[model samples]
Target: MWSGPPQPDEGLPTGLSAVSVPWKNLGPSKGHRESPGSLVENPASRKEAQGEEHSAAAPLDVSRLRSSSMEIREKGSEFLKEELYKAQKELKLKDEECERLCKVRAQLEQELEELTASLFQEAHKMVREANMKQAASEKQLKEAWGKIDMLQAEVTALKTLVITSTPASPNRELHPQLLSPTKAGPRKGHSRHKSTSSSLCPVVCPTAGHIPTPDKDGKELSALVRAAVEDNTLTIEPVASQTLPTVKVPTVECNNINTCALSGLARTCHHRIRLGDSESHYYISPSSRARITAVCNFFTYIRYIQQGLVRQDAEPMFWEIMRLRKGMSLAKLGFFPQEA
Candidate 1:
């Protein structure tokens, strides 16, 4: 073929006439017909093209997203487990502390109870001792009161006896038969002259002053004595209680014994008579005789007082005692022995 510029369709020669061709016929030949617009050719370009096609056509990867979510969940579970372990450990420590405190409280309570019981026991013992002492003191007080009451009653009885026995008869006289034993006998030089006789007599009268008056004749005194014997005013008894031990007492038969006879014939003479004798030595009932002797002894005391044997201040008491004893003898029939 000649290589030249082609003619237009309207001006082409007959040998070289323009042909009518199909649109497919415009493409290159098999080797060269691969136009860039028609078919893919470069390998990099094909891969790019394939990737774009996959992107457009493929579905989402749901399995990969699910695996990633599982990994995150496992990490959160481990964190929560660590926090739970810390909380459990704290709770255990708190429970142990609470138990220890409870034990300590129990021990304290037990000690307190023991102390309280001991104190109560001590208090009970003290109260019992005090009660016992109070009872003992009360008993002693009652006994002392009883003794005082008895002493008062005894004193009252004695006073009543003294008051009841005071008033006496106005007329009473000594009996001849009751005269002193000395009068029945003769004096020392006259023992050869007389014979003596004795008899018992009874007289009852109140105790009072019935002293014999100064009179030459014994007739009035004798009549009064007879009246006194009849009156029965004097009553003699053994002392109610014996103050002195071992002594004889005058008998009822001796009641009429004439106390005035002890003064001898001269009424002023104080010498008492002994049995059947004018002399002083021969006596029955020696103790009674001694008391009578003591009255005679009073004259000596009076003499000694004048000689100042006793102090001047004490002399009055001696005279008063002597006078009282003399009076008492007239009343009581027996003498109270005067102290030396």
Candidate 2:
């Protein structure tokens, strides 16, 4: 009902209005500049006046303000620097991980390429044939070899003969039975067997009891006498056991190495890689042939336990064996990768 004019906003002291005015007037409206001496009576009075004026207005918090502002600035700068350093470190770690992954990917790709190539298989074959006929090709090969060895031995023996011995005519045969088999019966438990292989047989002279004092031409005595085997086949046998030189041999026992099973193991692993064995094809690639030698030489770092003959040849293969040990699922060939 008393809405004559709109009142100012409330929530103030009852007697005070929202819009206020300073009622106390110091002088007339005409402005004038005062002398410095009149404005400040003395240093103490001026300071007291300034202090009272400051107190009358509002309290200003100056203590520790500049120091706190400086501290805050320093803390903010330090935090920014720490954040920047952390970001840089994280970026570096990410880069390193990416590089490692790239290298691994390259290696994997190479292995995949190799695995996709052609497959290979290791082959083995064995055959046995005892009887040999003069009409067969194998017989011709044996005959030629036997003749060569016999001729060489005869030449060597002839070199030792004195010039005083009787000479034979060119038409006469120096050894009549050189091409014929011995007619004497074989001794018990000592039989001969002719091999169908093209390998050469060693030459053996007759026993001391059958040696003649002088040479004979086309004589009735047999030059060589050997027993027959159970199969009625003839084979030349040396008086003593000896190792013959062989070509393209899979392995050789030498330098105090009694067995070369290590070589067999390496070959088997190579074959497995050539085949489609996934683990072998990927990990045991062809290039590993040369790499394994270097790696195996460093195997002195570990102590090894062995079961059979220990050989220098096995040093490299033993390390490979330890890595590719036999599992329950599968095993390598009996002659090769199993434990060569």
Candidate 3:
């Protein structure tokens, strides 16, 4: 039995009364009533409710999805920026390293050039020093060779003198008398032979073929002859004048004596003079020739004295010739004549 339509709140909960309708009032009303079981449901109303719920949930889901998508995009952008920064930093570092390496290479090349230049300079200095030393040594060697040649010549001259000076027989008289104006008488044992030009002693006079006598006119000539003998200008021959006997002659054993040694010495000296003339570099000037001639004359005098052919009084004159020869030698050697 239905008492009119049940109130809306009769069986429903308080909050659901607005949306839910009473099942007893679903159909016919007044004298006819419908049972709760016979209530007809509306398909359109259910469909509308479900559609509204679906629409509300869809909006919230869409907002959440959009926020998530925004977060993902922001994260991706940040990561890309970080990666780009890292790449740029790395590129900058690599560029700096490349620049540093290039600078080092340039510096090394410069140092190498400097070292090479210094080495070349050192080598050049060494070569120059060596060349200078070699030149000095060569000059010394030439001087030594010249001295050796001079000594060898002296040795050869001595050897020839020894060979030529053979002792005469013991019985033969070493002193032979030549033609002289002062001879008093002939000896008993000696035979007097006619005087010939060949038997005459060779005399070097200022005037050829003119013999100086003790007469007043020939006094000057005599003085000149004496001076020539003292100065060692002439070779010693057998004394043909009584004046030579007045001078103290050196007495020596006549054996093993070379009378021609003085002549050979003079010849050698003359040969040296010729050599000096031929090789101009060896003798610088005419003074050098004069010097050589003086030496020859001095040696000739020495040879005569050694052979006991000169007077003992000629000792002083020998010293004078030696002094003159020394001066000439000094001149040739580039020293002062006075110093010599």
Top candidate on TM-score is 3
lDDT of 3 by residue, 26-96 (tens): 54769887755554444455455545554555566567778988999999999999999999999999999
* Total backbone clashes of candidate 1, pairs 3 or more residues apart or in separate chains: 5
Candidate 3 local Cα displacement, residue 6, angstroms? 29
Model 2 segments beyond 4 Å from truth? 1-63, 119-340
Per-residue alpha-carbon lDDT of candidate 2 for residues 1-340, written as tens digits (9 for 90 to 100): 1113223435434443332223233342357656676546555654454445445433232334566789999999999999999999999999999999999999999988776652221111112222333347676886676677666544533332213223222111222211111222333332333341122222112221232222222121111111111111211111111221211211221111111112311121221111111111111222232233223222211212231122246677666556544321122222223322
lDDT of 1 at 271: 23
Sorted by TM-score, highest first, which candidate order results? 3, 1, 2
Most lDDT-accurate candidate: 3
Against the hidden reference, what TM-scores do the models get?
A: 0.34, 0.20, 0.38
Candidate 3 residue-wise lDDT at 30:
92
Mark the regions of model 3 whose C-alpha exceeds 4 Å error after superposition. 1-48, 59-63, 154-340
Worst 10 residues of 3 by lDDT: 265-274
Question: Using alpha carbons, what is the TM-score of model 3?
Answer: 0.38
